[model samples]
Target chain A: MSGGYPKGRIRREDLISAAAVVYGEAGYHGGSLREIAKRAGISHAGLLYHFPTKEALLAAVLERRDAEDADREQLGVPPGLEVLRRFLTLAEHNARHPGIVDLYSRLAAEAVTPGHPAHEYFERHYRDARHRVRDSLRVLADTGELRPGVDPDEAALAFIALMDGLQVQWLTTPSEVDLAGALRGFLQTLLTVPLQP
Target chain B: MSGGYPKGRIRREDLISAAAVVYGEAGYHGGSLREIAKRAGISHAGLLYHFPTKEALLAAVLERRDAEDADREQLGVPPGLEVLRRFLTLAEHNARHPGIVDLYSRLAAEAVTPGHPAHEYFERHYRDARHRVRDSLRVLADTGELRPGVDPDEAALAFIALMDGLQVQWLTTPSEVDLAGALRGFLQTLLTVPLQP
Candidate 1:
């Protein structure tokens, strides 16, 4: 369908986008593979040819989201306060993309159940997110940008929590909650240096 | 059956408990009244008699939780740093009751979809929660217990987000996340005095 793009690859991408919307609205538990296939304009058997199970499709969906976010934010580049700033920029990006935010928030909550298909995915995702945030905090601590007496690990956990928790509130009441502003306030309290770069 | 409790009232309570269990595990969209009825040892029609719709049952479940928390914490009493202390205590209680926490986190995330039955309920719930937290912060500010330059409203939002976000992380990896400790650390940064009362 496209220059140098295979038809199968395009179909797989279509399925992932459709799955994201279905899962975003009804959640994984409420969403069904049949519905996802319907949205993707494919036969159920054809969808199965690509993803043998709903769980497999979910894994792909999650991976695609992370890869896209990483590419957009330059996730690991220029680590330190810069990484934290990238997160603020990401939060701003999230404000404009409520669908992705909804999908993430819904799935993360649903995945807390021990045996949910995506439980392990979210567990690892958060662990990685925490590590990234903590790594940035450690860099700031070494550079004297972090305030005195702040624990890097604890601050890392808190910062991740703030970003996640703020999304839920912002989604519910968009007019009242300012996602990046709250994050900036929390960062300002934790850092001795200016965040404006 | 022996006490003065009426059969109808007891049946209603039983249905509510069963509905909570079903809705907690499967969320409102994925949960069914028939299953809830079966769990309560009643017919579907009987369950419907008590909770006209699934949405009605969800409302009852949410209200019961808030009523229980309010009763336990004396929500409006003291009205200052003491209110904040009650929240810390509530967080401790939530750690011991992961089921309630799971139910809440799941429902809150699900309710973010506009037109979700619990949408308005959560909107009002968060509004009330923010006002309560902000009211306490205002009290602390009046007495100079709050750190200088901290905005009460912003701090209140961050605190709520922290607690909500921490619960998700704690639920996912209970061994890694310390719910109350992170919260206390955040409060320590905002307040001049110890929260050990």
Candidate 2:
């Protein structure tokens, strides 16, 4: 019932958050467990106590990120445009967490391997996210907020594509691309509802 | 100037092409000069005869891929929907060579480092591609192909973002996501131009 934990134990979630920062900054191949431990202000032994292996640590980092994102978005039904607005906001906010973004990119590339540990996570993430977006558009369609004849599935795919694509650009050249603005404009033009007034 | 190599020595261009394939398959970190030489059907010394070091070989691989892509796309002139069409073709064709896609994804992630070899290539790539797309949209605008008051730059950015984003999906779940179809639909809808209806 309570989220509280023992005072002495380095909380697993805190260790994962710190690891995410390190992994994001240094990349999966470049990051070191010692550095993550240092960042969390804990001994390496303490860090290992929470995550027995580097892979476990990385997995925890990704899960923690997803949980945090879910928490921020409230993970419930909402208006179509509102859902998009919240998604864009979360994406922009994610930009500040360079570690998580970098980790996401690295894991994405690795996911190409059929047996990669993160492959299922990414696959399920995209599938579920696409369905969520499609459902939102369906709601909009039902409410007459969306123009008739629009394919909700295609629209959902486009939205997902834009998010993934912009993240690459943002990672490549963060200064030049305005992730949120571009998404807002693109969605406004694509969808019936205006993303911005 | 002789286009053909004289004698048994492998041409530098040939060596670079082979290296691209090897690196594309194994990744910059996972790949090695030995593997590249093996793939090229040459001795280690012969491989070094072209690219002196592993880093140099990696750089050559990325450079060759860029040059090949540019040459294929014909870097200078503005292409209209043809550009998107060509991109889709290339992406679909690339499905046969998963190595290239894997290499690109890997390099893109590592390209975050300012001094990384692929950094400049991707930066100029995005900028140049953006300009080309924008120019194409300008042509569309002048011919009244786009809806009135549509911003070409924003449209171009969105198009590129869509391509980048969908590629992630294509790479992740090629079976489920029809990348080219999704892209063509999104572009047609965004530009309000009928695609050979």
Candidate 3:
């Protein structure tokens, strides 16, 4: 799958990667297709071949990021603590991908509109991610990993909120803060459950 | 100061407020002076009379929002717990003002440029805000409201990160999540040392 593109043929994944970099640096509105193409070393037509429009390209960039994140984390139906670990790992990875962070921030602001394309994506993404976290907490509860009578749903929501909130701070002040470390410390404290060594 | 505009004169504050709303809804590029004037029930000349340029208008909008936030929270130098309470209150207030949130998001995205007007605003905003938070934590530590030997700076950074990360999530999924409740819960857990209730 990696080697299928010819020497000059812009691979879909490569195009998306380039788009992410451009979007991250300049924002969706600030970035231009021509610039993304220039960065990718391809013509505008060539870039548009993979992504028909800027909107499509933005959606593709976000979708590819989500898929890559899932793959990188190998995120699965793990127990709560394990899920928390995966979530933190993903946040750490996002620290390196400022583009994805910016894209998420931009889309989030835009999502306030009733029918933005990314609106449904963000909505479903949160819903599913929250459910996964909740299920993990349930497993931890069953195994006595969490304190008795802890509300998994609330805990999961708080955990997700923490992750989401930190990214915004990181974007504005990347030089002064270690967002991943902060989150890890907070999560470690929350996960009173003993880890399987 | 409240009557600074005089009767029937559109105050500078009113123009700034209208600019914030226009920029928040239509984005900086998409928003125009004419539209802002229309929103303010004034002519374009009237809008420009207060703000010499679009950049000036943007700066005023951002500054005005910050002032309003500071006034509403009555945020001042305080202990860590008090700082946390003020931060949470301000965040809740911000959540209610989706327009300001949107404007901040847009400006943050634009701030990637080293010399963008909002760039300095954000850089100093975070630096000063973090310093204030750290100072508050130091006070808390001195009063034994923090766990012994805990790093106040790290705690401050973590709390700020949590707020920023949570705001992103809240904006992304406002319909389904109670951002204030989630933040309160997270902060409660993060504070290991019990204060005198």
> Candidate 1: misplaced stretches above 4 Å?
A1-5, B1-5
Residues A68-160 of candidate 1: C-alpha lDDT, one tens digit per residue: 999998887765988888999899999999999999999999999889989999899889888988888889999999999999899989999
**Deviation from native of the Cα of residue B41 in model 3, angstroms:** 4.6
How much of the true A–B contact set does each candidate keep?
Answer: 0.88, 0.74, 0.56
> Global CA lDDT of candidate 1, please?
0.91
lDDT of 2 by residue, A25-113 (tens): 55555568898888888889987877788888877777877888888877664646677778878877877776567778766765666
Worst 10 residues of 1 chain A by lDDT: A1-10
Compared to the true structure, candidate 3 yields what TM-score?
Answer: 0.83
Candidates sorted by DockQ, descending order? 1, 2, 3
Between the candidate structures 1 and 3, which one is better when assessed by lDDT? 1
User: Which CAPRI tier for candidate 2?
Assistant: medium
Q: Model 2 segments beyond 4 Å from truth?
A: A1-14, A29-48, B1-26, B30-46, B71-81
The C-alpha TM-scores of every prediction are 0.96, 0.86, 0.83
Quantify all predictions' global Cα lDDT against the true fold: 0.91, 0.74, 0.72
Pick the TM-score winner.
1
lDDT string, candidate 1, B61-92, tens digits: 98899899999988877658888888999999
